[model samples]
Target: MILAAGRGMRMRPLTDTTPKPLLQLRGKPLMQWSLEALARGGFDRLVINTAWLGEQIGERFADWPQQHPGADLRFSHEGQDFGYALETAGGISRALPLLGEVFWVLAGDVYAPDFLFSRESVERFVASDRLAHLWLVPNPPHNPRGDFGITADGLALNQAEQKYTYSTIGLYHRALFEQPWCDVVPGNPQGTAVPLAPLLRKAMDAGLVSAELYTGPWTDVGTPERLAELQVD
Candidate 1:
């Protein structure tokens, strides 16, 4: 699932009209880069959660099935159901029906141009006992402190001396968002706003999460300047 619901407060004026994922980057809609990459990676279905000018996102990619023959698109329209975009966990909860027991998640606005969504990686994650597997990236200037710490055993820890940013790309098992950690109530259709980090931290404490450092060209296009730099490249 591509998380395209953020208000994109950081992207400001540019996002004032367009959803950040729909914003053009290097002559293509940013989310399309992920869609194309997923197709190349052997994925066939997609569930995109959208808000903040999300209609455009739907309209723009309405023809994805035609564009990529075998691939299909399904949207979890958060704006219509909840009147706004639910944060990460909420959005995922709302879309759980579309996404089965295990699924892939990626932030729509991030520009990981060379990052390949590996089928082998997904297969490995599914086979493992871990509830979630995240990809971490080196801290960017905008978020210098980073989010989580990676342990020697490849498990994600709540905190550590050397931290890395959550790449917003991961494989998740639906159970993590259900009952014990938080009452996401994925069995229902309604959603509540909730950030994903706390839930991830809760699971990490129990050693249910794993992670890997992605040493690739990753850009968080949080501002117009970063978007422009990417365009220049």
Candidate 2:
């Protein structure tokens, strides 16, 4: 699932007219990079959660299936249903029906050109007992504090002296949305907004989350300046 529902407040007027994921990076739409990567990794179906100019996303990718033979693209319109973007977890929970038992998720607005959505990684995560496997990146300038830490055994730490930023790329199990880890009703009928950190932290405490440091080119294209940097690169 590609998470594309954010309002992109940081991007301001640029996002006022276009959803952040649809914003241009290099020569194509930002989210298209992830789509092409997933397709190259042998993933045939994709689910994108959208809000904040969601219709344009659908129209823009309407022919993606034809462009990539065997690829299936679908969207969950949070804005149309609830009038705003449901925060990360809420958006994921609402789209749970389409995601199935295990899936890969990444933010559509991030620039990670070197990241590969490998099938081996998926198989390894699926074989593990973990509920989620996140890719952690070195702290970027914008997020110097980082988000979480990893132990020798690779379990994600809720608190640690050395922390890393979540790359927003992960393999998740459907069980994470069930009782104990989360309480959001299936399909998020109430359209309740929920962030994913709380759930990840709770799971981290239980040793149900694992992570690996990803040292690759990555940028959270949340602002015009950051987007410009990528364009220049």
Per-candidate Cα lDDT values, in order, are 0.89, 0.93
Clashes of each: 0, 0
Top lDDT model: 2
- Across 82-147, the per-residue lDDT of candidate 2 in tens digits comes to 999889999999999898899999999988888899989999998899999999999989899999
Backbone clash tally (model 1): 0
RMSD (CA, Å), candidate 2 to true, equals 0.8
Give candidate 1 regions above 4 Å deviation: none
Checking candidate 1 for backbone clashes, the offending pairs are none
Error of 2 at 7 (Å): 0.8
